[model samples]
Target: MRQQSSPHLSRGFSSYGCALALAALVALAACSKKEAAAPAPRPVVASIVHPDGQALQAGSLPGEVQARYSTPLSFRVGGKIIERRVRLGDTVKNGEIVALLDPADAQKNAASAQAQLDAAQHNLVYAQQQLERDKAQAKENLIAPAQLEQTTNAYASALAQRDQAQQQAALAKNQLQYTTLVAGHAGVITAEQADTGQNVSAGQAVYNLAWSGDVDVLCDVPESALAAFAVGQNASVTLAALPGRKFSARVRELSPAADQQSRTWRARLTLAQPGPDVRLGMTADVTPAVPLATAAAQHGLFTLPATALFHEGRQPAVWVVRAADNTLELRRVTVTRYDERTIVVSEGLKDGESVVLQGVHTVSAGEKVRAIAPLHPEDFAS
Candidate 1:
C-alpha cells in the first residue's frame, strides 16, 4: 500500500520548480544583453601642435686638436747623431740647434776640399806668370807660336780647375754646416724620432715642430651633412683633457671630396684665442650650428614624438584627431627631419591640431577615440 502526500506540500514543490526556471531564464537574458552592448571608446595619448620655430638642433662629432702648421725637421746630410739637445715637448727658438752629428768626417772632407782649392790656386798663378812671359816672347817673335799657344791653353785649363775646386769647397762647407740640425722656426717640439748615437739618413724625420700660435679642431663629416657645414660656420668645441670649459671655433676648411676609407669629408675649425690648455693631439668634441628648417616655419610648424610617425605607402603619416567628433583621421604629412625622439613636420595639419603621440598603431582610421593628456617629455628623461 502507497502513502499519499499532503496538498500544501505538493503546491510548495511545484512553486519552487517554477521559481528556479524563471531565475535561469532571467540570468540568460541578462548575459545576452551584456554581450550585445558596444565597447568603450579607444583611449589615446595626443599632443597639441607647436612649431619648432627658432629652435635649433645641434650635431656633435669627435675631433682632434692640431696645429694649423706643422713641420717635420730632418737632416740635409746623413750622419750619426752625436747629441740631441731637445726632447719631446721642448720649446725651441729659431736658429736653435736641436741635434748634432759626428763632425769628424765632415771636418776631414772640408779640410781636404780646402787643400785642393789651395793647390789649384797655386797652379793657376804659376800658369798665369808663364803665359805672360810666353805672350811677351811671342810678341817679340822670340819663341814659336805653337809654344805660346800651348801655354795659353795650359792657363785656361788651370782656370777651369780652380773654378771646379771652388765649387767643391763651397759644397764641403755646406755639408759641414748640415751636420748640425737647427730649427728654422720657433715652436714646441711635438715629436723626436732620433736620439744620440742613432744614425739617420738624409731627409729622415728627426723632429716634428708645431707652431703654437693658431689651433684647429679637425673632424670628419658625412656626405649627408656636408652641405650644412661651410668654411665660415661657427661651432663650439669641448676637449677631453679640459673639462668644464668650452671653446669657440670657426670652420676653416671643408674637404670637397670624401675620404676613400671613411667616405667622410674632413673639416677643420680654427679656435678663437686658444689657451695653453688646448694641447696638440687632444681629443675634441665639435658641436656644429644647425640652421632653421625653413623660413616658412617662422609662423609655426608641428613637431611630434617619433612614435606618432607611421608609414602609409612609403610616405610618413600621422593620426590627427578631428575636433568635431574626436575621431581619428589618417593625415599624410611631410617630414622635414627626424631624430631618435622627435619628428619635425614642415607641412601637414594646421596649428593647434592634436595628433596621437602614443598608441598610434593600435587605433584605426575614423575610429572614435578618447583623448588623454600626453605625458611630459621630461618625465621620460634619462
Candidate 2:
C-alpha cells in the first residue's frame, strides 16, 4: 500500500508541472504575436529648411494702381446736362469741357441781371443830373438847403445800387459759365457719374478724374504686416495686367488708423517713374524688401506652412527628422510671426535640417518615420 501511494503522489506532481509549463508556452506565443503586429514607421511629408530672405521680405500684398491726385469733377451750378463730351478713361486737358448743362435758364438769368444793371445805371445818371441841378439852384439861392441835401443823398444811393447791380451781373455771367463742367486738371476720367440728359445739382460730381501725374499703388495691409512697411520705404510693384514688368515704388502714405471692418491699414506707394502703361485701376502686387542687415536675416529666419507647427502643452514645437535612424524629435521653435498660410520661425532651427511639413499631429517623439518631399512643391516655394 505505501508503494502504491508514492507512485500516485509522483504522478500528481508531474501533472501539475506539465500544466504550468503549457501555460508558460501559451504566454510566450502571445507575446511574440504582439511584437509582430507592432506598427511600422509612418510616412510624412517634409522639407529641408533654409534661411529664406524672401520670408523676411514678407511676401507680396495685393494692390491696385491709382493716381496720386484724384478729384471729382462737378458742376458749380444746378442744371440739366445737355451733352457729355468725355467717356470713362478719356484723357482731358486742364479746363477742358467734359460735360455741358442746359444753359437756357442761365441765359435768362444773365439777361435779367443785365437789364437790372442797365436800369440801375440810368437811375444813377438821372440822380446825378438832379443833384447837380439842385446844387446849382442852391448856389443861386433858388433851392432850400434841405432839398439840395436830399438830392445829393439820392445820387449816393443810386451809385450804390448801380454797383450792386454790376456785381449781380458778373455773378450771373459766372453762373452761366459754371453750367459747363470742365476738368480742373489734366487727368483721365476714371468714372462717369452723370451722363447726357441727366439733371445734377450744384457741386454734384459728374466725373471722377485721376490727375495724370504721379501714379500710386494702393494696398491694404493687415496689422501683422504693418511693421514691415514705413513711409518713404522703397518697394517693388508688379502688375498682373502688365506681366513681366516691375515698377519701383516708395511708400508715400500709411493710414494712421486701421479700417474698422477689415482691420487693415491703407497704404499708398508712389511709383518713381510710372509709365503710361501703368494705368489707373490696374491690379498690382507690392513687395517690400527686407534688408540683409535686419535682425530676422541675421538670425536666419525660415518660413514654413502653418501645418508644420505643433503644440506641446501650449508651447510651439515642430517635428525634426533625425538623420541617423529616420526618427522624429520634437523641437521647440521661436515663432516670430504667424501669417494666414505660413509661419515665420526665427530660431531653434538650423539650415539644411529636415522638418516634417505636414501631418505633424500624427507624429510623436522617438517614432520612426519616412521623410519625403511634399506633393505640392509650390506650397513651400519662398
TM-score per candidate, in order? Answer: 0.61, 0.64
lDDT of 2 by residue, 268-294 (tens): 999999987777889998887744224
Q: Residue by residue across 1-382, what tens digits does model 1's lDDT show?
A: 9999999999999999999999999999999899878677788988666555323354577899999999999999999999999999999999999999998999999999999999999999999999999999999999999999999999999999999999999999999999999999888999988888999999999999997689989998754455446789888899989999999999999998878767668999999989987789999988767533332244345657788888788999999999899999999999866656777677887867888888777889999888887668553221
**Candidate 1 TM-score over all chains jointly:** 0.61
Using lDDT as the measure, the top candidate is: 2
Which segments of model 2 are wrong by more than 4 Å? Answer: 1-58, 291-382
For each candidate, the alpha-carbon lDDT, in order, equals: 0.84, 0.86
